[model samples]
Target chain A: MRKIKMIVEYDGSNYHGFQSQKNAHTIQDTIENALYKLTGHKIPIISAGRTDRGVHALGQVIAFETEAKIPSDKFYLALNSVLPEDIRILNSKEVETDFHPRFQAIKKQYSYYIYTKDSGKTFLRKFAWCNSEPLNIDDMIKACKQFEGRHNFLSFCSSGSSVKTFERTIEVCQLQQKNAYLKFDIKANGFLYNMARIIVGTVVDVGRGKIKVNDINDIIKARDRNAAGSTAPPQGLYLMYVEY
Target chain B: MRKIKMIVEYDGSNYHGFQSQKNAHTIQDTIENALYKLTGHKIPIISAGRTDRGVHALGQVIAFETEAKIPSDKFYLALNSVLPEDIRILNSKEVETDFHPRFQAIKKQYSYYIYTKDSGKTFLRKFAWCNSEPLNIDDMIKACKQFEGRHNFLSFCSSGSSVKTFERTIEVCQLQQKNAYLKFDIKANGFLYNMARIIVGTVVDVGRGKIKVNDINDIIKARDRNAAGSTAPPQGLYLMYVEY
Candidate 1:
C-alpha cells in the first residue's frame, strides 16, 4: 500500500462540513466518492483540520493509503477531473507510510473576513461577514496582541469537544484592513472547537465597544465559555494553511 | 407618481439575464416582483445596462415610477427586505420625472477579471476567469491604448444589436495586475452589443501571442466581426458603474 498526501481547497458554502455524515453533502464524502469512482475502492482519508459548516479552506491537508496504481504526482489532476468544481486537489504526492495529517501538524493558519461597508457587495455575501455598523479598528488591533501567547482558551472553546486540555499556544494574531474589508489572521499550534470564531467574536465585540480592550486578559483568565463574546458565523472563517 | 433612481448590485449566476422574459428568472423580473410586493402594483424598471446572463454588476443604475407612499431614500431598505440575498440596492433617491436610466447616462465603467494561477482559488472561481498559462501582460497593456478615442467598433460588436451607429469613444482603457489576478477596466461614452467582452477577448488573445500588438489598428479598420477575437465569457464581466 502507498500513502498519498494532498493539499485540498474548497468553498464550503454548499457543504455541511468537512466530515462525513448520513444523507448529507460534505467535502470529505464528495472527494471520497470521487476517489471511489477513480480507484474503484472505498478509501478512508484523514485530514489536518475538520472545518465547520460554511467554513472555507485554501490549503487543507489530507492523507490516505491506497493500493491503486495511479502515480502519486498525477493524483491531483486525475481527481480534479472527477471532483466537483467547488472542491479541488491543489497538490498531491507520495508520503511515508506512517505520515499522518492531523497528529504530525505543527502550525495552522486561519483568517476571518469582515465586510464593513454600509452596503453589501453581492459578490462577497457568501464569503464574508457583513457588518454595516462602524467598528473601532484600532481597538480591535490592540486586542489582537492579547491573544499571542500560551493560554487556557476554555473561554473561547465551544461545548462537546473531546480534548485533553484547554491550553494552546498562539504564535501570531493580527488584523488588517483593506478598503472596507477587515481580515483577522491567527496562527497557532492547535485550535479547540470554535476557538478561532470565538476569539474573532470577542475581538469584534471589543471593536464595537461592548468589550473593553483592557479586559481581554481577564476574559482569557476567566476560563468560562460565557465570559467570551458570541461566536462569529462560520461563513467568514477560512482555514488558510497547515504546516507539518 | 414619483420617479426613483437606485444603484443596484447583483451576482448574476442564478439569473438568466438582466432583462425579463416569460417564465425565466432574471434580475429585472425579481426586482419588479419585489416592487409589486411592496407597492401592490405592477411596476417596470429601466436599467442603464442590460447585462448578459452570468454577468455581475456593482453599480448598475435603474429607475422606476412608483405610487407607494414610502420615502424615496427608505425605498432601498424596504425593497432590500423583500429581495433575495443575491440582489441589493446600494443607494436610492427621488429623481425628476423626466430622468431616464439609459438615455441620459454620460459614461459607464466595466471590468473583466482573469485569474492566471496554476490552481484555482475556490473563493474566486465564481468571480474570475481562471487561465493557468502564462500571459504576456506587457503586450496586453500596449494593446489597451489602441482602444482609446472615437472609433467604429463594428468589429467588436456582436450580432442582435439595434444601435444606429457603431462609433463610440473609449475614455479610458487600462490593465492592472495584482499577483495572479488581472483586471481589464474600460470606461466609455457608450457600448455596442457585447462590445466590452469582445474587446477583452481580443486583448487576451494579444496577451497569449495569438495576435500581434501592431495588428490592432488593422483589426479595428476591418470593421468586421470576424476580424476581432472571440467573445469573452459573461461570467468574467462586471458592469462596474454607470455615470449620469
Candidate 2:
C-alpha cells in the first residue's frame, strides 16, 4: 500500500462541514465517495482540520493509504472529475506510511473576510460577510495585535467544547482593508471550536467603539464566555493553509 | 413626478435574463418587485441593455418615474433592505424627465472571464468559464486588436436577428491575464444578438491555436454566419457599463 498526501480547496457553503457525519452531506463524505469510485477503498480519509459549516478552505491537507497503481499526478485529475464543482484537489503526492497531517502540522493559518459597502456587491456575496456599519480599521488592527502571542483563550472558544486544555499560541494576527472589504489573517498552533469567529467578533466590537482595545486584557484574564463578545458568523472564515 | 436613474449590479446565476419575461425570474422583475415594495408603484423598468440568461451586470443603468416621498439618497438603503442578496442598486439619483437608459447611451462595455486552472474551485465557478487547456494570451491580444474600428459585422451577428444594419464601431478590445484567469474587455456603440459572445468565442479560438489572428479579416468580409466562431456561453459574459 502507498500513502498519498493531498492538498485540497473547497467552497463550503452547502456542506454540513469538513468532517463526515452519519446521514449528513459533508466534504469528507464527498471525497470518500470519489475515492471509492476510483480505488474501491472504503477507508477513512484523515484531514488536518475539521472545519465548521459554511467555512471555506484553500489548502486543506489530507492523507490516505491506497493499493491502486494510479500515478500521483493522475489522481488529481481523476478525483476532480468525480468530485463536485466546489471541491478540488490542488496537488497529490506519495508520502511515508507514518505521515500524519495533524501530528506533523506545526502551524495553521486562517482568513476572515468582511464586506463593508453595498457598491461592490458582485458575485462575492457567498465568500465574504456584509457589515453595513462603518468600521474603524485602526482600532480593529490594534485589537488584532493583542491577539498575538500565547494566551488561555477559553473565553474565545465555544461553551461546550470538550478539549484537554484552553491554552494555545498565536503566531500572528494582521488586518488589512481591500476596496470594500476588511480581511484578517491569523496563524496559530491550534484553534478551539469557534475561536476565530469569537476573536473576530471581539475585534469588530473594538472597531465599533463598544469594547476598548485595552479591555482585551480583562476579557482574556476572565476566561469566561460571557466576558467576550458574541461569536461572529461562520461563512466568513476560511482555512487558508497548514505548515508542516 | 421624478425620473430616477440608477446604477445596478447583480449576480445573474439564477435569473432567466435581465429583461422581464413571461413566467420567468429576471433582474428587471426582481428590481421592480423591490420598487413596488418600497413605493407601492407597479411601473415598468427601462434598462440600458437586456442581458441574456446567466449574464451578469456591473453598472447596468435603469430609468423609471416615481412619486414616492423618499429622498433619492435613502433609496439605496431602502431598496437594498428588500432586494435579494444577488441584486443591488449601487447609485440612485433623480434625472431629467427626458433621460433614457438606451436612447441616450453613447457606448456600452462588456467583459468575459475564463478560468484556466483546475485548482481552488470556489464561488467564482458560477461567474466564469473554465477552460483546462493552456492559452496563448499574446496571440489572443493580437487578434483582439484586429476587432477594433468600424466594421460590417454581419458574420459575427447571430442568425435571425432583425436589425436595420450590421454596422457598429468598436472603441476597444483589450485582453489581460490575472493569475489563472484570462479576462477581455470590449466597448462598442451597439451590439447585435450574441455579438459579444461570438467575438469572445473567436478570440478564445485564437488563444487555443485553432485559428490564425489574420483570419478575422476574411471572416468579417464574408458576411456569412458560418464564417465566425460559435457563440460563447452566457455565464462568462458581463454587461460592464453603459456610458450616457
Candidate closest to the true structure, highest lDDT: 1
**Model 2, runs deviating above 4 Å:** A39-41, A66-69, B1-3, B33-42, B65-76, B95-99
lDDT of 2 by residue, B53-96 (tens): 99999889999998898897677778888999899888889999
| Highest DockQ model number | 1
Clashing pairs in 1: none
Cα interface RMSD of each candidate: 1.9, 1.7
What does candidate 2's lDDT look like per residue over A1-244, in tens digits? 8889999999998899999999899999999999999888785899999999899999899999888888976777788888898998988999999999987998999999998876655677678777869778999999999989999999898976889899999999889998778999999999988999999999999999999999998999899989999787888889999999
lDDT of 2 at A214: 97
